[model samples]
Target: MNLTAESVAEALVVNVDEERIDAAVAIQFKDRMRDLTAGAGGRIILDLGRVIFVDSSGLGAIVSVMKFLAPAHRLELAGLTPNVGRVFHLTRMDSVFPIHADVAAALHGAGHDL
Candidate 1:
């Protein structure tokens, strides 16, 4: 798994390079995200453009990250591939979190608060 973090506009853009976000990679993904958001004091935009697949464990990891952020930090998802989008739709997680079609949209929706 590979993750890269960069400051984009007012949000932190986390680009995931993993092919799958499943049980095998959940822990690492969660830990990396935690570190990326640490003291950043801004909304996080997880760019899932490179993530081709996601499973229950992956979704759980993402949910855990959001929970960790709580009412303080904000986390949003963007550029979900079709397969991952299907997962989110199947799990109804699309309603639970904000999903954007691209990084620009996600950052804009975050309102430059980051």
Candidate 2:
């Protein structure tokens, strides 16, 4: 549940500083994400570059976060590892989210002048 948030351009970049998001950390992750994103504006870019694994609970938590953000804010994902990306693809969650190859790409895709 090591997540850090910072404002970059027009997006709020949240970096997942953990190798895995599993059952044990799912609740913590969700709670921390809520805390981090409270009152935030614009797109939320979740940077998962360091995350190598994400279990069902982790995915659920992520989806829950998106739901929480609602039409007010968008939750995008960036830097998914091969294994983690497969889980999203196999589950078809990739279509549900805006996935980018990296944080910079995400920003660029969002029309940032970076």
Candidate 3:
């Protein structure tokens, strides 16, 4: 749950410093995300570059974050490792989220101030 939140352009960039996002950390992840993104505006980008694995619970937690952001805000995914990216693709979550190659690409895609 070593998540670091920063404002990059018009987005809130959350960097997951952990190597795995599994059952053990799913709830913590969700709670932490809620805390970090509370009352936030615009897009929230999750930088999962350091995360090597993500279990079903983890994915569910992520989805919860997306749902929580709802009407006023957005949740985007960036820096997905190969395995994690495969999981999203296989689960078709890739279509549900705005997946970017990396944080920079995400910013560029949104035309945010780099």
Give each model a TM-score.
0.91, 0.94, 0.93
Return the clash pairs for model 3, or none: none
Ordered by TM-score, highest first, the candidates read 2, 3, 1
Candidate 1 segments exceeding 4 Å error? 109-114
Candidates, ranked, lDDT: 2, 3, 1
What is the alpha-carbon lDDT of model 3 when measured against the actual structure? 0.88
Candidate 2 scores a C-alpha RMSD against the true structure in Å of 2.8
Q: Supply candidate 3's per-residue lDDT for 80.
A: 90
lDDT top scorer: 2
lDDT of 2 by residue, 28-93 (tens): 999999999999988899999999999898999999999999889879999999999999988999
For model 1, how many clashes? Answer: 0
Quick one: how many clashes does candidate 3 have?
A: 0
Top TM-score prediction, candidate number:
2
Model 2 spans > 4 angstroms off: 111-114
Q: Model 1 — TM-score against the truth?
A: 0.91
* Tens digits of per-residue lDDT for model 3, 3-96: 9899999889999999999999999999999999987787899999999999888999999889988867768899899999888888998888
Show pairs that collide, candidate 1. Answer: none
Local distance difference test values of all predictions, in order: 0.84, 0.90, 0.88
